[model samples]
Target: MPAHFRQERTKIVVTADNEVNIQTLTNWKVSVPFLVMLSDSSNITMPITIEDTLNQCFTQETTEQIIHLSPVCANLLRRVTASDPPFKLISVTPSPVGESGEARCIIQGKGIVSLEAVNQLGEHFLLATTYLSVGEYGIHFSTENLANGVYGIILRAADGREQRSVIVIER
Candidate 1:
């Protein structure tokens, strides 16, 4: 199992245009779900922190059931809907960039612009930019130029909607 699938939901703090403090994956299609706060929404005010529930989707009926079970979970689902977690990945066959079984990752979303991987101590890995696509970003993630164990992912949106999420980069 991957931390993105379990572990404490990545914490996203929405400050007053102040700055998104860090912390934090991809692909053989690893899903990095994030509930981002859009700047265009009239209903959104600043300084609101959104925690937990990344890359989660639920229909209205399902949402109702979740609410019945746990109001906290239901509220998270609603927040995730407002900013919609990135894409579940359209598709990737035999490595998006690296050779077959080369441990590749692709973080695809409309607003995601930059991607970074960090280790347990918040140390960043020196990533090679060769595999990066023009629009659809791809990373040839590995344990060499990067760390071995699981790390945190820091993804920033072009619209200034920043999010923090967990990812398991296993060799």
Candidate 2:
């Protein structure tokens, strides 16, 4: 006998002794929406099971399919759609320096780049901004007017990506 029941949040459960294997299909036609709905409405504990089932079915799925299931799977598949870091910090030179000194670094990537200097007290000071082509570029900045302390040199891309490094200045 097949069992049918409804739960508090309009969740319907149907159980039967059928020999249908859901994992054999190349694409999920009816199951994706149901899994998505379960993920969005169910508690974290219950959603784990649903997420596991979705993962099993989508083992061979494409990135687009994974992205489409991310929202419903509570961002379980977010890595598939996440953006890569816009830049790589090759190196930062002269970590400890005098108040009036020059600092330089090589950054490699492609994007509109901007930088900020943040103090311990959470104060942000703009350093530089420019568009970089798809290659390695050099960055130079002066600490002539900066006070003696530690500061974070933050590099940001127009696409909202960021990288940070620290520097200490002493008199």
Candidate 3:
């Protein structure tokens, strides 16, 4: 997998024209989520950092706070907090458009799985349904004589978990 890094910073300032405006500054709150990826293919999510700076000008007080992520160290955080299942469907890459030649469907997963192909009307066609061990696996299917429409590639794990992806076959 490719690696990605990103850094972001946000600053907020408040000014007081009278006493009432200054009191509202104390009620301000901020929250941020930072993504950190680990070597073991895991991720951590937390707040980066917050810095507060107060400056006194002529007769008014200016308060500024900066929230930023450190560029030196970070990780890839998962967008969803839901726990991952033992068998994960990483991806299903199919040839987007193709002619009457051979079109392929690549199913990637973590554990044992069985794959099948279905039409747009939810009709299951037994393409390749066999138990695959724990790792990444790929299977190739022909598009010859098939209609020019969308077909669904469904992968079922040994534990009964299933993932579906669609591929378009064009004449």
Best-matching candidate per lDDT: 2
> Predictions ranked by lDDT, top down?
2, 3, 1
lDDT of 1 by residue, 14-98 (tens): 2222322222211111122434333211123222223336424322234322111122333342213223334332222232223
Tell me the TM-score of each prediction against the true structure. Answer: 0.28, 0.42, 0.39
Q: What are the runs in model 2 whose C-alpha is more than 4 Å off?
A: 1-86, 99-110
The whole-model C-alpha lDDT of candidate 2 against the native structure comes to 0.44
Clashing pairs in 1: 24-152, 24-153, 27-105, 33-55
Worst 10 residues of 1 by lDDT: 21-30
Rank candidates, TM-score, best first.
Answer: 2, 3, 1
Query: Which runs in model 1 stand beyond 4 Å of their true positions?
Result: 1-112, 126-138, 160-171
lDDT of each: 0.33, 0.44, 0.40
Superior candidate under lDDT, 2 versus 3: 2
lDDT of 3 at 170: 60
Shift of residue 20 alpha carbon in model 1, Å: 34
Task: Please report how far candidate 2 places residue 137 from its true position, in Å.
Answer: 1.5
